[model samples]
Target: MSSPRRVTLSPTSSAASSAGFGAGSFVVGSLGGGSSFSIRSTLSARACLDCFSPSVSAMGAPPAPRQHQSEPATRQSVQSPPIATTAVFSALVERAQTQYAKSGDRYIGYRVLGDGPIDLLALNNGSNIWIDRDDEPHWAHFDRRLSSFTRLIRFDPSGVGLSDPLGAGELPTVELWTQDALAVLNAVESEHAALLGVSDGGPVAMLLSAMYPERISALVLMNSSARIARDDDYPCGIPQHLLDRFVNTVSDPTGGEDRVDDLALLAPSLAGDPEFQLWWKTAGERSAGPTTAKALDTLATAFDVRGILPLIRVPTLVMYRLDHPFLRPGHAHYLAEHVAGAKLVELPGRDHLAYVGETEPLLDEIEEFLTGTRGGSDTERVLATILFTDIVDSTKRASTAGDRLWREQLDNHDRMAARQLQRFGGRQVKSTGDGLLATFDGPARAIQCGLAMCDGARQLGMDVRVGIHTGEVERRGTDIAGIGVHIASRVQACAEPGEVWVSRTLTDLLAGSAVTFADRGDHTLKGVPGTWQLFKVEG
Candidate 1:
C-alpha cells in the first residue's frame, strides 16, 4: 500500500482535524475493485457544506484512472478525528491551491482528508502529486494508520494519475519532489507536520526533515533506503546501469507493464499478489509514463543526506525488512547510525514495503515516537502587522497578453511594488501567486506600503487590493503567523480592486501615517471568528 496523499498550509503545512478526508472538497469519484464497490471520496471538506454557505478550487481533464484489480478489502472502518476550526481549514485550503497549481505540468488538484491525528500529506511518490479518491477504499491499512492521527491528505504529484505529466527535464531530482511536498504543505498552510515516507518517498522525507527541521515533528521511514546505488563495498545494492534501465521501462508511458525491481522490491509479502502488482502498476501508469523510472535514475546517484543527518534533531523511526531488495537492511542500519538519535526498527518478516507485511509493530513504534516525546523548541514569537495583496483579474490579463508578455509585465509589477515597500520601511513577507504579503513596524507604514503597491501595480494596468492588520504573531523558525495573518488575508479579499483595506487594529496603529479610512462597517469573514470592522483607505 502507498502512503497517504497530502495538502497543507505550511511546515509547509499544519494538519486538518475533522471527521473524514473531504473537509474542503465537493466533487467525488470511484477507483480499484472491491475497493471500487466501496469508494472513499476525498474526505468531504468539513467546510464544503459551509463553503458556499461559502467555500473553495483545481483544473484539467484529470488524467486517466489509476486502476487496479483488488480482492475485497479487510474492511476496517476508521473513526474520524475532530473537525478543524475554521481558521485551520481556511489556512489549509488557501495553501493547498497555492501549492497544487505549481505542478511542473498541468494544474494539480486536491481533496481534504480530515481523518487522522497529526496532519499528513501523502505526497504521491510518482510523476504527479495528486490522489484518486476512488482508490481510497482499497487502501484500508493506509487509512487506518493515517486516521490514527489527526489529519491526513493524499494527492498526485505531477504528470501522473489525474494530473498532467511534465517532461523528463521537469523533475530533475528528489529536490523537485521535496519541493512538491513543500508546495502541498504550503497549500495546506501548515507550519509543522510529521514526515511518514514509504518506498521512493524515503529520501524526500529525510530531506524535508533535515532542510526544515522546525516544520517536521517526527520522521517515519518504511521499506525505504538512504541510497540504492552500489557503494563499492555494497554489491547487493542496485547497479547504476540496472537503475537506468528500470527507469526506462517503468516510466515509458507507452512501455509495457513488465514491472521491474523497484516495484518488485516494495512488498516482499505482496510482490506475488496480483492485486498488489496491478495497484503498483496502475499508480505508476496513472501518474506519468516511465516517470518512476526517471525518478529511479535520479535517485540512484542523486541524493546526499550526509551533511543533513546530524541536523535532523526530530524524533525518528526507521523500518525495514531483513529480506527487502531495493534498499538492503544495511542501508537502514547506516541511516540510523547517521541520523543522530534515530531508532532502527527491523520488521520480522522481510517486506520491503512498510505499508505491507506485519504492520502492528511498525505502527506501535510510530505511535510511541509521536506520543512519547517532544523535541526542543527554539521557536521565536513576536507582534507585527501582516498584509495580503492580490491582483484583480490577473488570470485574464495574463491570458490576454500570453505567457511571454504577461511574464514580463508580472516581473515589472513585482519589482515596482517591492521598491515602494522598501521605501516605506516595510518588510516584504511573501508573494501570493500574483500578489504579495508584507509587514510593517507601524500601521502608517503598512497603509502607505499597501497604497503604493496598488498604485505601482496600476501602472502595469493591473488593479490590486491590499489588506492589513496588527496582532500577536508567532515566529516559527522563519515564517510569521497567527490569527492576525489570516484576518489580514480575508480583509484583503474584502477590498475592492485598487483599494487598500485595514483591520481596526491597523487604523489605530497608524496615528502618524498620512492615511485615512472610511469604515465599511462590521462584517463576518469566511472562516474568521466574530464580526470585524474593516476600513478602506480613502487617500
Candidate 2:
C-alpha cells in the first residue's frame, strides 16, 4: 500500500478529487467493450474495431486517435484553478496539473494537443453531482477520437462541476456565463477560436460570438435553446412550466432520477459509448450535489439569450437533432435564421451529443463548415416576430431629471423594461442612455411587453411611448442597427404619451396569436422612406 497525500479543501471537492482519485481499477457491465479498453490501452484500429462492439461499428468510423486505451484512467498533467475561480470553475481545476492564473482565485483549466493555431473551447452542459465514476481515465474511445487536431479547453462554470462553490446570491445569467467564457479565452491567450457548445452551453457560444465576433471563428451548437421557456408549438423544448418543475427538482438531495434522465438525454449520442457514458455520468455526479437545486433554479428561470443571434458575425453551424427531448430543431432553426450567415443542418439520429451518436456525418459537416468548403449557404430566412423597443423623449427626460436623479429613474425604467422583457421571452440588448432596446422571440410578447412597460412607467409617474417593429436588424455593439431598429424607433416616436405603437411588420407577425392590433393609420417619419402601416397595441 502507498502512503496517502495530505489534502487541502478549496470548497470545490470535485477539483480536489484529482488528488483524491488515484485508484486504477476498471469495471464494466453487460454492455462491455473489449477487455483491452483501459483508459491508457493502445488499441490498433483493428482492436478498437472489435472493442466498440458490432453495434457501434455499424454506426460509422471515427477519426484517427493518438493515444491507446491501455493506460489507466487519469488526468493528464495540466494546471488547476485557484481557490476563488474554483467555486465558479470546478471541472477545469479538479483535473488540472497546474493553475491557469494565480490572481485572486480566478483561473481556468486548459489542455493543448494536436497542432497549434486554432483554440477550441468546450463549454459544460449542466452536470449534476452524484455520479462517482472516473470516466476519462478509463474511457479509451474518447481519448482516441478527440486527441487529434483540436486543442480542447474545458472549464466548470460557477456553482457546479469541479470548480469552487459559489455564493447563493451570485447571478449566473447568460451575460455572466459568457463573461466566464471570455475570461477563459483571455487567460489562455487565445486571440480567436471556434466555439463548440453542448446543451445549455449553446447560449454561451451565441453570446460569446455576439460580444466578441472577432475572436470566434465559428460555432457548433448542439441541443441548445436561446430561451429556456417553451411554447405549445415547441413540445420537446423546455417549457416555462417545466422549468419551474426543474427548479423544484434540482433542490432535491438525491438528484432526482427525472433530472438525471433528462440530463442523460442531452447526450443521447453517448448511450452506446459506454466509456463516454461513464465519464459523463461520473462528472455530473461529482459536480453539484442534490441540493444544488437552487443553482439550477437560477439558471432555468433566468437564462434567456435569444437576442444575441443577430449579433453573430462568425461562421456557424447550428446542428440540432430532430427529436431532442430537451431542445428541438425549432430552436436550432431560430438560431440559423437569426445569425447573419450561419448554416443549419438536420441529419439522421436523435442524439444531442456531437462526440457520440452518429458523429461521422456531424464531423463531416463540421469539417466542411470550418473549411468553408461546404460554401457560404444563406440558410437564414426572414422571421417576422423580432421586436425592438427603446424609451422615448430620453433627451428631454435626461435634461429634466439631471444627472443623478435622472440616472436613478432611468435605472428604474430599465429594470421595469427588463422584467417585462424576461416575462415575454424577449432579449435585452445593451442599454441605451435613459432607455432600453430589446427583442422578443414572439410578436405577442413584444406587443404585450410594450404595453406593460408603458403602463408600468405611468404607475411610476413617468410617461413614455413604446415602439416595436419586427424585421431583420444588423447588430451594432450592444444595440441593434439597420431598418428594424430605425422602424421601431420611428414607431416609438409616433406613439402618443402613455401608448404603444407597432409597425405593420409587427402586426403581420401577430396573426397566429390571440392578441390583435388596431390600425393606427399610415405614417411617414423623418429619414424613413415609404409609408408604414402602424397599429396600436390592443387585446
Candidate 3:
C-alpha cells in the first residue's frame, strides 16, 4: 500500500493561525493522486487558507492530510523559524527588490517602502535587503505595519547583503557604518528621518544621531546596548572572553550545529522548531561568509556609543527585552540614563530578536512614541484587488496527457504562477483546479500580474483566462470571502479563452494608469444584482 498523502499548512500571520501550522514556515500542500503546488503570501499577511482539495494524490497515491503540531496558536511572523521546502523558501526570497546607493567607490543596497508622514530608517545587522523579502510572514507584517504609520527606509551596511563587501581582514568601524547610513539617507533624498536601531545597529544610530543632529529627527533602539563589551564603568555588558567565544561560534561556518543550538538562546520562542534551525543556518551562510561575519562581530565588540549619548539632541526611546541573556537589562537602563530625556521601556520576553515574542506590544510602544497615537487593532477586513484565472480546456488536456505528464505540467504552472505573484507583489489565495486566485493591494499590480500569468500559460502550451475586480473583502481567518471574490470569479467566466477580463470597478480604479482596456460592453453577471460593465485588457 502507498503511504498516505500529507498536506502541510503553516501560519505566516495571526490571520493565518486558524488553519494550524502556527509556527511552521512556507506553505506547501503536495497531494498524491492530483497535483502538488506551492502557496505565496502578499506584501503583508492576509488570510491564507490551504485551498488544496486532495481527492487523489499527484503521485498516484491515496490522499491523506496531517498537521505538523497540535501546539496552541503562536503568532508566527517571517521572524519565526522557517519550516518549508527549499523551492518555497527561495520563492519567498525572490520577492526582494534591492536598490543601490553610491557611497564613494562602494555601493550600498537599500529599499524604500511606504509613504507615511515620517521617514523611519531601519538599521538592522546584516539584514537590510535580505530581511525585507518577507521570508517570514510576520516580518513582512511588521514592516507593513510600520509603513502604515511611517515612511520606512531600510538599507544594508558595507559587507552585508547586496552591498559592497569588505576586503580580506578589513573590519568596519562605527564611523564607516554611520557613513553607510548617511549615504542611504542621501540616496533617497531624505533630509531628516527617524532612526530605528536594532541590536548592534543601535551604536551606529547613536553615532549618526550624535554627529548629524540636524539630519535626525528622533531615535529608537531595541534589544541593543550603547556598549556591547563589558568595561569597568559598565559591569553588565558581555564579558570580553565570552563575547569572543560567542563571535567565534557565530562566525564558524563549519560549526553550524553550534549556531543552531545558540539560535535557540537568541530566540527561545522558536527553540523547538526544527525548520527554524535549518533556516537559521541557511540564512547565516547566505548573508555573509565566516570571515566577514567574524570581522563584523569583532567590530561590534568595540562598539561603545555611551560618550555620544549626551550629544544626541533628538527625542530618544530605548527599549529592550528584559530577560535576554546576551543583552541584559542594565544596557537598556544605562542608555536611558545617559541619553538626555530618553524614555526606557522594559519589554517582557526572553527572545533576543525584536520581531519575536509579543511583537505587537513593541509595535504599540513604537507607534505611540513616533506617531503620538496607538493605532487600532489588526483589521479583519481590508480593501484589496482580487484576481482570478481559469485554465481553458484543462480537463480534456489532462485526460489526453495522462496523470504523470499532467502532474509535471501542473508543477510547472505552479512555479510560473509563484514567480508572477512575487514579481507583481500579488498574494496567492489558493489553487482553483487548473487556475489560481490571488489578491493585490493595487489594481494596476493585479492587472499586470493577470496579464503576466496569461502570457506565461501560453508558453506552457496552455490558455488561461483572467478576471480582476477591486473591492473590500472580509478576512475569514485564513480564507477570504465576500462579493468581491465572487464577482472576480464571475468576471473571469466572461472572458474568452486566453483573454483577460475585468469588472468596471477595477477599470475605474485603474483610470490614468499605464494599463489600458477595451470596452467589452455592459452585461448582466450571473447571480448578481445590477448590470456590470466589463473590459478586455489591451495588449
Candidate 4:
C-alpha cells in the first residue's frame, strides 16, 4: 500500500453556502495511487447524483472542528417526564426532508441535518429507517450529539426504507450498498466525510473506506464485525445452525407480529418496555418487509471484509459493548488488530443496539476521538417542553378590583393552575408574577395544560395567554434556564388574550393528536435567534 494521497474538497457554490456549509477547504485521501491535481467542475445532468460542483485536491488530514457548547441555565424545579409513545414523539421533533440520490437506475433515499464542520455519514443497519428514528428519544439524542460536532448525513441503503427495493430474486451485496452510499455523498457534494456504521452496516463502511480511501476521512464501527458467520478458521462468528435459525426467524411471513424474541436479542434492556417494543415492531415493519429482511440477513452472513481490513489506511475507531451477545468483544478485537492504527474502545453493556442503555459514555468516547475534546459541561441539559402563562392586563385588572380583591383573584388563579399542572403531570418551575412557568415531558400534555389554564383563568373573570416550545433546556438546581426557556417566554409574549399559542415544535409533536392548530404565521421572537413559526391551539 502506498502512502494514501490526500484530497481537498472546497464548497464554492452559493447553493452549498446557503445550505449551512461554510466555504473552506477540507482534507481527504485515497488509499490507491493517484497523482494530485485540482479541477473546478460541476456535476453533469445525471439522473441520480445531481448537486453542486466541487473542486478536489490531493487528500490530506481534515482540519480540527471548532468547539461547540450549549448555553447555561438556572433551575427552580425539576422532575422527570413520563416516557411518551412513538405516535406522540414523531410529531415532537421536526424531521429533515428526505431527498434522493440516484445510484445507477435506482434511487437512494437520504436526509441531511445539522451544520457542524465535519460531515459524518450514518450508515444504519438495513432494518432501521430515518423517519422512524425520531420515534425513540435515545436514538434522536444520539443523532443530535453526533450532529453537534459534525454535519450528520443519514440514508437508507439500497432496497430498504425509502430507497427502491431490490427486484424479485435479486440479492443485496456490499458492493451495491457501497454504491448507494457514494451516490448519497455525491448528491450532497461531500467529497470527504467520516463514516459511522452500526451493526451490519460496519462491513460496508470498511469496504468503502478501503476501496475509496480518498473520500473517507475516518471510520467508526459500533457493535459490528468484519464477518458475522462462523467457519473453521473463524470460530468467533455465529455458528451455522444459529445463523440458520436467525435467518428463518426474520423470514417469517407473520412480520412484526412477534418481534419480542428479536427485541430481546437486539436490546435486552428495552425488551420489557412495552412502548419500546411497539416502536421496534412498527419501525421494523416500515423499514423492510419479510423478503427484504431475509435477503439483507442472508447477505450479511456472507460478509467477510477481513481481506480488505488491512487495506484500510484512514483513522479508525472500533467500539463495541463488552457484553453484546452476538457482536461480542472478539469482533472489535479483530477489527482493531487488522485495521492499521485502529483504536478500540470497549463499553460495558448488554444491548447490541447503540441507542439502548447508557449511551452517553459511548457518545463521549466518539466525541473525544473525533474532536480531541470531551466537551463536557457542569450543567445538565435535556429535551423538554416549556410552558409559560401570563394573566392578560394584570395591572389594569388589579386596579379595577383593588389590592385585596386582586390578591383573592390571584390566589384563586394559582390554585386553579396547580390543579391543572398536577393533572397534566407538569412541574411548575416558578411563578412569573402574574402567571406561572412549567415544564412537561410531552408537548401534548403541555398544550393541554395551557388550554386548561386559559379555561381556568376565564372562570376566575381573568384572561390568560399561554405559550409553549420544546427544545433542550439547561437544568440549574430548582430552576431551568437556556435559550429554550427564552424562546418559550417570547412565545408567550406573542400570544393573544385568552389564547394558547405554541411554537411550531409543539405542533409538530402533536401532529396525530386530537388537538388541532391554526397557523399564527412566523414571527421574530424577541431575544430569540431566528424567526419561529407559531400556531394557535384551536378550542
Candidate 5:
C-alpha cells in the first residue's frame, strides 16, 4: 500500500496559526507514498496504550451470542426519571437549537461545548445524540470527563438524531455520512479535531480520516469495526445468518420490549437494570423509527472500509472490549494491524458501549494520546472532608426575584457562605452555582462550616441543604474529582431544606467533636455504588 503524504507547518506559518494548531502539536495535512513524520513532544503511541493495565481487570470469558428474547412484562414498565431532570439533558433539550451544516440540501445538527485546548468531535453510534439525554447517568460519565479536557462538539448525522431524517426508501451511504461530519466541523469553525467514534460510528471516522486528512488530527475508534459481515478473510464479521436474523428483528418494530435484544448485545451490563432497560427502549424509539433503523442496519451490513484503513495518516487509537458480543476482538486486531501507527487497547468488559464499566481507563488513554497527559484521579489523591451545599428551589427563587434581584441575592448568599468557610477553617473550593463546595482538613471543621452556612442562608430567607463526607479525593488541578465527590453530592441531594446530611464516615471522624447526628439509615444514592449510611447533623 502507498504511504500518505505529510505537510509540516512552522510556528510562524499563517495557515497553521489561523487553523489554531498549537506550536508543538503535530499536524498531518496529507500523505505521500512511503512518507514518514515525527512528533516532537507527544508521547509514543505504544507507551500511552501499554502504560495503564493495573486498573484494568484481567480478560474474562467471551460474551454469549445475543439472543432474541422478549423482555419480561414487569421489566417493560420500570420507572425512571424524566429525561429533563439531568442538567446536561435539560440543557440539551432547552438548547435544541442546533447549528445547521449543509451537506447537499440536507443539514446535519450539531452542538459545541467547552473551550479546552483540543477540539474533540464525538461521533454517535448511528443513534440520535438527543437520545443520550434519556439515560443521563450513563451519558454524563462521558460528557463530564471529555468536556473537562477538550472543546467537545457532538452532532447527529443525516437520517439520525435531530438532523434531517432520511427520505422514504432512502438509505445513508458512507460518502453522505462523511459529508455530514465535515459539514459539522465547518459549522463549528474547527480546522481539525480528533474524532472519537463509538460503535458503528467507527467506520465513518475511519473514512473521514482517510479522505479528509487535513481536517482530522487524530482518530479514536471505540468498539467499532470496518465491516459487519463475515467472509473468508474476515472471520470476525457477524455470520451471514446472524446478520439476517438481527436485521429482521430490528426491521420489525413491535414495541420497546423488542429492543431489549439489541440492548442486550450493545450494553449487556445495563440490560439487566430495569430502569436502564426502560430508558434504552425509550431512547431507541425516539432516536429513529422502524424504517430508519432498518435502513441504518442495512447500511451497516454493507460497510467495508478495509481499503481505507491503510490510507489513514494521522494518529489512531482503537479501543475494544475483549468480550464484546457482536464486534469481536479479531475485528479490533484487524483495524490495528492495517492502520499504520494505530494503537489498539483491549479493555476488559463484555459491554460494547464505551460509557459502561470503568470509563476512566478509556478517558485516560484518550487524554494521554491527545494531550500527553492522563487526567483524572490518576494525578494525586488525598483524604479530606468534602462539603456540598445547595439552595433549595433555587430556580423558583430566581424566577420570583427576577434576574437582577436574583443575582444580588445569590451574591449575598455566596458571601455569607464564604465567611462561614473562613470562620470554620474550611477552604472554599468552588461555587455550586446556587451554593458552594468547600473542603476541610477535619470533619469537625466541615460540619461547622455546613451548619453556619445553613443558618446564614436561613437568615437570608433562603433555605439550603448541606451534605458532608470524609473520604479520599483526587486533586485535578484547581478542582477535585472522585467517587467521594459524587457521594457527597448525592448525600446533599438526599437532604431536605435547612437540613445538614453527612455520611457515616464524617460522623465517625467527628466522634470527639461537639457535632452530633441522627441516623438517616442506609439509602441508595442515585448513580453511586453501594448503600451509604447517612446522618442528619445536630449541633
Candidate 6:
C-alpha cells in the first residue's frame, strides 16, 4: 500500500514557534494515476469564483482573467475644498480615480483625494489602499478631515493591494516599497509632500525622509515601532515566544480569524461592534491571502530602523497610544528621543488601527503638528473621561509575595491592566507603581474597562478598586494634567475592594449603556471647591 499524500505548512523564521526544516522548502508527494486529486479538483471548481473576485480589481477595473499587463499611469483633477464637508467629501473619493505609478518593472496603485494647500502622502501598513477606500465611512472621514487643509495622496506598495502583484514567491523589501512610494509621488507630480506612515509604513517613511529629505516636508508616524524583534538593546520588540505564536497564526488556514484577533487587539474599542468587525474581516480578506500575509509578517519581524532615526532631517511627529497592544509608548519615545526635533504626542486610546475608536484626537494632533493648526482652530481643551485604578492592599500583597515574585506578578498585572485599558479605548497617562491613570473619550468605556480590570485582578488572586469621572481636560505633550485628574484620583480613593465607583458626571454620560449604578450619596472631595455626588456601578 502507498502512503497517503499530506500537505504540511512550515515556518520560515528561526524565531518560528515550531522547530522544522530550512526556510522556503516545500515537500510534495507524487500521485499515481489511480489516485484522485481532490485538492486540485476543489481548486478547479473555485476558479470561477477567483475570476470574478472584486479583490483582483486593478486600476479601478476587474483584472482580465489569466492576463498580465502593466497599467499606464493616470490622474484626475480634484477641486480643492475650502473645508471638506460631508456631502462634498463623499462625492470626492467616490469620483476619485486610481492611477498607476511605474517602479522598476512593476506598477504600483495610487489615488489622489484632494488638491488642498499641502500635499500629503499616506502609506498604509502593508495593506491595499484601495481596500481602505471600501471602508467609506472611516476612510472618507479621515480623507475629508485631512483634505480640508492638504492634498491627500494614498498608494499601495508594489505586490500588495490593487498594485501589480510580484512573481510567485516574490516578497517585497523595505527598500523596494520605499521606491514604490517615491514612484507614486513622481506619477502624481508632487515635488514635495509630508509623509504619514501608519504602523509598518513607519520604517518606509523614515527611510524616505532620511534618503530624500528634499522631497519630504515633514513626517508623521502613528502606532509604529523602530524594530519588531526583541534584543539586548531593544526590549520593546515582541519576544521570541510571542513572535513564534504570531507567525504560526499568520500562516494558519484560519488566519482570517487571527487577523480579526489582531484587529481586536489593535482596536479593542471597535472589536465588539458588528459593523466594524465585518468591515475589518472583509478588508483583511481582500487585502491579501495567508501566504502573502505570512510573507509580509516575516519581513516586518526583521525590520529595524534604529540606525536611521538620526539621519532624518524633516520635522517629525511620533504619535502612539499609550496602551497599544502591539506597539508600546516606549517605541514612540525612542523615535522622539533619537530623531532630532521630533515631537511625540501620546494620544488617549489603545487602538493601533488608526480608523477605529477615538481617531479625532490623533487627527487633531497630526493636523496641528503638520500645519500649525488643529481642524483650522487653536483650541486644545476637549471633553474627556478619566479613569483611575489602584490595587487594594497592594503593600501587603507585595510583602506576602516577596520582592522577586511580587515584581513578576506586578509586571503581569501591569500588562493585564494595559490590555483592559486598550480594550476600552483608554489612553494610559502614567503608572503609579501600584495602579494606573488613564483618559478616555467616553465614560461608558471607562466604566466597562474598570469593571473588567476588577474581574481580571480577581482572576489573578488580587483585588482592585476603580474610579471614573467625565470632564474637560487640557492636552499637554504626551500627557494630560488638569483638575480632572485630581477628581478621578479622589473618586478611586473612595472605592472599596473590588468595587467600581464613578462621579455623577460619568453616570449621566452613560445614559443609554446597559450599565447600572447605585447612588453613593454626596461627598466632599479634597482639594476641590464643591461637594459632589458619587455612585457605585451595579452588576
After superposing candidate 3 on the true structure, give the runs of residues whose Cα lies further than 4 Å from its correct spot: 1-96, 131-133, 256-260, 373-539
- Could you give candidate 1's per-residue lDDT for residues 1-539 as a string of tens digits? 11222222221112232111111211110111111111111212222222111111100112222222222112132233332333433443344331354543445555555433345566544422233323422244444454445455666554345544556454434544555565556665555657777655666677666555556667777666665555575443555555554445434445343433343334446555665556555554444334444544445344444434554555666666555444555666767777766666665555544445555555444444454324552324344568788889889988899999988988998898889887877777777778887876445557778888888887877899888886656666556787768998899999999999888765533322245689999989889989999999997
Model 1's TM-score against the true structure:
0.49
Clashes counted in candidate 4 amount to 21
Off by over 4 Å in 1: 1-107, 115-117, 127-138, 232-236, 252-263, 291-297, 377-539
Query: Candidates' TM-scores?
Result: 0.49, 0.51, 0.51, 0.53, 0.53, 0.52
The local distance difference test score of each candidate is 0.54, 0.50, 0.62, 0.64, 0.62, 0.62
What's the CA error at residue 539 for candidate 3, in Å? 64
| Candidate 3, 272-390: lDDT as tens digits | 56655455555556666666666666666656656446556566777776666556667887887787667667666777666656676566656555544211212444556789988
Question: For candidate 2, lDDT tens digit of each residue in 7-88?
Answer: 2212122112111111111100000111111111111323222222232222201122223122222222212311122233
Q: State each candidate's clash count.
A: 76, 36, 14, 21, 5, 0
Candidate 3: residue 433 lDDT (0-100): 79
**Candidate 4 ranges with C-alpha deviation above 4 Å:** 1-95, 127-130, 255-260, 373-539
Segments of candidate 5 deviating more than 4 angstroms: 1-85, 88-97, 125-127, 131-135, 255-260, 373-539
How big is the positional error of residue 498 in model 4, measured in Å on the Cα after superposition? 84
lDDT of 6 by residue, 1-539 (tens): 11212112111111111111111101010001000000101112122222212222210111222211122112222222132344656566675688898987898887777655555677664444563454546656656776655556777776567888877756656656767777777776665546677776777777666655555666777777777666788766666655655555534554233222454445567556676556555665666666666666655655676755666656666777766655655677788788876666666666666765556666655555554421111135444678999999989999998999999988988999989987877899889999998987456668889999999999988988998876646679878877878898899999889999998765543432346799999889999889999999995
lDDT, candidate 4, 222-316, per-residue tens: 78887776667665776665665556554565533322255555666877677766766666666766666667666666566665566666677
TM-score of 3: 0.51
Overall local distance difference test of candidate 1: 0.54
Pairwise lDDT winner, candidates 1 and 3: 3
Comparison by TM-score, 1 against 2, better one: 2
